[model samples]
Target chain A: MTSYIHGEIETPVGPLPRIATKWTHLDRWGALKTRWSVGRMKYRVRPGIYAVGNPDRDSRVFVTGNFKLSFDHLRRNLEGLNCWILVIDTKGINVWCAAGKGSFGTKEVVRRIRIHHLAQLVDQRKLILPQLSAPGVSAHEVRKMTGFTVVYGPVLARDIRAFLDAGLKASDEMRQVNFPLFERLKLIPVDIFYGKQYMLIVPLVFLALSGLNPQGYSFDLALNSGWKPVVNLFSGYLAGCALTPALLPWIPFRRFSIKGVVTGWFVAVPLLLAGTLGISLMEKVSWFLMMGGLSSFMAMNFTGSTTFTSLSGVQKEMKTALPAQIAMASLGLAGWIITRFIFI
Target chain B: MNRFVYLTDVVTLELDVTKCTGCRMCLVVCPHAVFGIENKRAVILNKDLCMECGACAKNCPEGAINVKSGVGCAAGIINGLLRGTEPTCDCGEGSSSCC
Candidate 1:
């Protein structure tokens, strides 16, 4: 274990814990672990002031949330620059989410400034905050309370060096948020991992229900009949969670639920056609309903991962989509029951 | 963003041009480049690009901007529905108990 105090870097304010911008073996391992587990929710640092590189009182001060990943990303990008980092306690949340939640608001920033006696340490009375943090922080209010001007920095930390070099004026490109393919792809793990519990429950319930048919409750019959429904359910999962996000921009509709339905049909139609060669028409209809509804439900969940939809917009979508999803799934279940008991 | 375009005309973002001081604060804070300064006033360059994060409205000294700002995540919304509350992102620093 690396001692937390192993290499204390000295600063004008005081000696503080230091870390390198480059990823260590431990960091790589942590990243892998976090990808699989709920570690992003738990990974955090003690919120306080820290120094990056050897710095005098004149060094710039940057503020951010205490989520270790957010902290690490910020510091790593500042490799050779001597600066001061004042971390606020957002309970391990990142800058963007924390700012929306009020944890990264005016009060916390003022409190951290006062507690750290930052005014005495830095000659400049200015704080550079992540642009995303602007929502919860009023620059005018911060100036009024702390006597320090808040300069909203670029949206991404990687642009900080250029932002500073250009006299703290961000270019148009620095302010834009880009959801490129890689960024979209990285979110897939979290989406799949978070949905795991529900994924397990849905399939098991479908399997158990498959056994309650008129023919017999034999495990062999259950396995034979249950496989198709289970496959259909998971097909929806793959369509909604995996395929939808990967092809997000290319997908047809603006609403994520609609996109999921479109993608779900793409996957479900082929599967239904392949598996229902000898099945009854009622069973086929049930499969179609289940596939569409499940896919839509799963796809609607992607609204959280997307960048464009607003809260009200999402609410509007759920208002329209949820009831239809419930009705379709319910009717599909009814059809399955009827086909097993009456048509069999 | 130019690379991706979300639902157009859906965001409830509005700007009072008369109230805008043309300080370009909205241009500075917005992650989506949703605003542009034209003729000493802020204009919606690409209204469809607005993510409704509210960074611009919060930072606007003139109070010229209005947006219903909140997290846009769906899991949070569904959780809110089940719990009888407004949907919110709690992945970090949020008040919601669920992640």
Candidate 2:
């Protein structure tokens, strides 16, 4: 219900809502909260027309999704500038994802433009859209449907000011998407958070399986036999989910599965050496195989977060690696069960 | 981008210079700077950098660009494998696979 009033204007969609030019502390806090929250489903705004800095008929109109973070970034970056903010109902998805899904698309843009009476509010027939939204929005179609021309702004909202100041010309740097170490590392928490259930489930299953002995269900016997398998499983999970992503570039593998296996081995070797004194050779080999497979699977999951992987490439990797991973982990688990129950 | 290169020779993006109008729409829409303008024609500058999001191909008016673009997330791929369909990034689709 928050509104900003710079000037009175009538629209086919009703009265235009107003927004502040300056972003407040609450906005920043909301952004931070949403970043850590699961799925960010609650972080969204009502979609419609909004004004910033007392925009007039000559002001530039910018289009964005109703995801609060996207909206906040767009508006906050435009502080001290007068412009028309046209938000599309994207069901809380961000511009890039929504664009891919076709929610932030030509039809929606044209509909919003007509409903908001944007042509009458702005003298210029240009609508600035986020560059990432290009996939969903066809400029030619927008122009054909509505008189407004679509001018793709910079890839990042922070560069919007510079792009606008330079007459809407984007530099090479503005166009590039940089996925730095910090950015990659920040994404780890969410990945780890989402994988938490599996993290707990896998080790607990291993522990339960390891505890079943010829002597029956004895807690002490289970604790003795199951602890190593639990540790190895957890180690593999962390190696795949956390270590592989952190050392993505330096991990010495073109494939994520390989990188994960390498990381898993890196962790497993020390544990293997430290814990091998009393355990059978089959048990040691089983731990190595299980850890390697588990880590590889976990690391492969990270392909979704990386900026370089393609859909085909991931499928290709999965085709080759997934079967190998399944074989290794399966054989290793079979070895462990045989050693604990039959050999012991 | 220079600091940490993820994978090489995986992108399917290509530019047909003969059909390119040099409108620079590819340059404008590509977040990875995969395309560059030379002699008023588009060229693939960094093919490896492409994530295949399909923005350039979608925005190209002359139909000079081609790429098999889609979300490159593994969760989406896994979901697709389970469902026996083409993988789509879960970020947009109300799925638990994405954050």
Candidate 3:
């Protein structure tokens, strides 16, 4: 009775890495995309109850939104903790976002609880939830429906151990949400990813416009023509994506768009003044229009990240500000073209 | 930090004081100091300075806070809107399709 041995698997005595091999720091587009058998993080996951730690009926249960990133962060941070992790699919969005959209609301929690047979698995009717999951989850409603008392956990998963140790209560600092420089910076990649889409289009349009000139401009002129628009495009990108985010808290403004505009203007000032020193009126107007367009356009983007803007507020801005910026850019393009053919 | 009031009157982030509790959580978390204590309750003193990160709402114990939380970038919002769903980017909302 010789049993065939499978390939020898290398082993380490120490605990395996807390994170799965797929987990990595979030890139410019949120967490980097993964190709695994589990179908990756952001996919629409099946809703169910999972165990962070196997336990009898007395183990504590934690509730989380089904957004894979949220679940991943929680599970990764939990490390050695033993508890039952209940995940309610909010259609693959994080707790905070799901809460805002109501996918993480009371009915879903109760439904998941009943569907997952949570009552039979655990003796206690307590569920620890991420603090940000409150918007859609009506505590009163969940209690009425499922009889489980909801205890709000800290904003970050790293503090969960301390919270459970302290009698299921969040410490003062645990309750506070800090948007530190690194935290704010973490969002830059997503911003850059989205911005890149627009960035790709803007320059291409300007390049075509440069070649549209009928005066048969020299190759040097055509080549140089793109240089300014390129600078303008980068300046605008920096204004909205990099500068606005990095200096967010200190930008001396309320509306993110306005703050973005101010930031763009600040960067644009030196260049604008420098470009205008000996340039013609056509160039000067074109420069001003470009600056105005880029500044406003960059600032307009600040609406989504900042605290001051509203849905209606942003819509209104897009309505009024967008046209103005586009008009300015068009004016600049028109002026540049006219200067190329009619005047210069 | 008080360089210019660029966001002045551009956006309004208001907290319904009737719903507020003096948790003092918003105080510690805000990067912009947009909130302050007034008579034991949190007030949006510098409301215009808010980045709408949903941190205060998340930390508020009473469920009394509300905010339009999403990305502050234009491209992010436009992209969200084009998808025909809510635009929350705490990695929480369903932007997983973008993944």
Best by TM-score: 1
Q: What's the count of clashing pairs in each model shown?
A: 2, 3, 17
Superior by TM-score: candidate 1 or candidate 2? 1
**Candidate 3 at residue A15, lDDT?**
20
- Give lDDT tens digits, candidate 1, residues A1-344: 53222367765556777656676777667667665555566777788887777766888999999877788788878888888889999888778878887889999999999988899888898899998898789887899999999998898899998999999978888877777778777777777765666777878887777776576666776677777778887887778887888988888887888888889888977886787411888888787787778778878887776656677677778888998888888998888867777554
Q: How accurate is candidate 2 locally (lDDT)?
A: 0.80
Best by DockQ, which number? 2
Estimate every model's Cα lDDT from 0 to 1. Answer: 0.79, 0.80, 0.62
lDDT of 3 at A66: 66
Q: What ranking emerges by DockQ with the best candidate at the front?
A: 2, 1, 3
Ranking by TM-score: 1, 2, 3
Query: Per-residue lDDT of B24-94 in model 1, one digit per residue for the tens?
Result: 88888888778888998999988877778888888898999999888777778776777787776655333
Per-prediction TM-score to the true structure, in the order listed? 0.92, 0.90, 0.71
Deviation (Å) of A176 in candidate 2: 0.2
* lDDT tens readout by residue for model 2, A139-164: 98899899899998888899998998
